[model samples]
Target: MFKWKRKKKWYRDFVNPVHEFRYAMEFVEETLEEEKTKEDQILILDFILSVIREDLKYDTLTNIFYREKWFDEGLRISLPFPYHYYDEKGNMLSIYEDKAEVKKVDLAKECVLVFPWHRGRMRDNIKNIGRNEFQYDKFNHKAYYFSPVNICFVYNGMHSITAGIGFKKGYIEAAEYDVTKLFEHVYTDGLYWYNRHNNQKLEDDLLDFRIGVIYEISKIKHHIEKDAT
Candidate 1:
């Protein structure tokens, strides 16, 4: 007979104190892994930027998407960048579609400014829950959800890296800096703790890029439809 025993507080009964500690540790470990991944991403971005800075001839910037793999552990993710070009006036050029119409803008000449997207309190709550599953699952059986923070960089044809964050409006502008330095900072900081502890090497991975591009394209298409109205 498969009889389900119903306790007064099913959560409290099933989740023990020791189990809670184990869950907390797991969450901490996962957080460490995520940090390491972010560091690796920064490293790759920096490398690409350095190439851009060194050689001014190569002006086209292509979007890169790294596929996620099981072997990647925490180092697999996507990276996206716009096709960056320059005008005769030393202006940064980028193309974006507005309402089914391709629009070109000179970033350097335009007054357009980008701000970092606010990763709202809801996202923070999700992150906390992902880290503390034991406590979360005890209170509610619902699955945990987390919104990841994306770290981006701006690079010229030569190799240099500039750190920035994405926004709903567009990419935020970061200070011009070296790519290697960015990677070193991330590796030395709290980011790479888990990878170092686990003896893992960061790889160039970009699974998120593939997924995001599709969504972004779809959104652009929708925007175009809206603009035609």
Candidate 2:
């Protein structure tokens, strides 16, 4: 007689961290496929929008750069209603339903405005965790973030990450301006930044489109070190 071996659970403590992370991502992939109808095509964007809030078929920004994830001809996700609904006063009603919640329609009579939906899903995703595991704020300052370890620098002046954060955090926005300081990340937009104590405003940079994430996080490590000195 042969002795049978036990099957180890993937979630068992013995698994490596990297392997766990990869498996978690794969499980997310599998769930997207399961949540489909007979005629709908599944997409990767449907899964890793781990950050964005909408259950949209294709996000506008992602569709522009990563086109394959979206099915529509344009970046807009499919609206919940085939015909636009409005009150007697002509104000549009707010309805952020998924495609499943919507009714089939004859396009000739349908009208709708499918503006981007927002409920700040990213903030809800990582509201609480260990200090080593992060969200955005630290050292009495806030972070401009894209992903973990890809956050703003602790440097006391303006940098690319600051500009991006400034746009998101309400310190700055899309506009034309000139650069007076430099940072590790750059916004392709013509927007600019000013120092913490300065009252002056920057115009914009005509040439600042950047590809790839910039990591001056080594600078963050240095900032932490010098603060302790």
Q: Report RMSD for candidate 2.
A: 24.7
Candidates' lDDT values, in order? 0.27, 0.26
- The runs of at least 3 residues in candidate 1 whose Cα sits more than 4 Å from the true structure, single-residue gaps closed, are 1-78, 83-209, 212-216
lDDT of 1 by residue, 1-229 (tens): 2234455367678875345434533443444356445444344433433333322211211121122222311222122322232333434433221122212222222122121122232245335434442121212211111111122222221111101111112122332212211111112111221122333423323222222222222233333345556
lDDT of 2 by residue, 69-90 (tens): 3332323222111112233353
How much is 69 displaced in model 2, in angstroms?
46
**Candidate 2, residue 150: CA error in Å?**
12
Give model 1's clash tally. 23
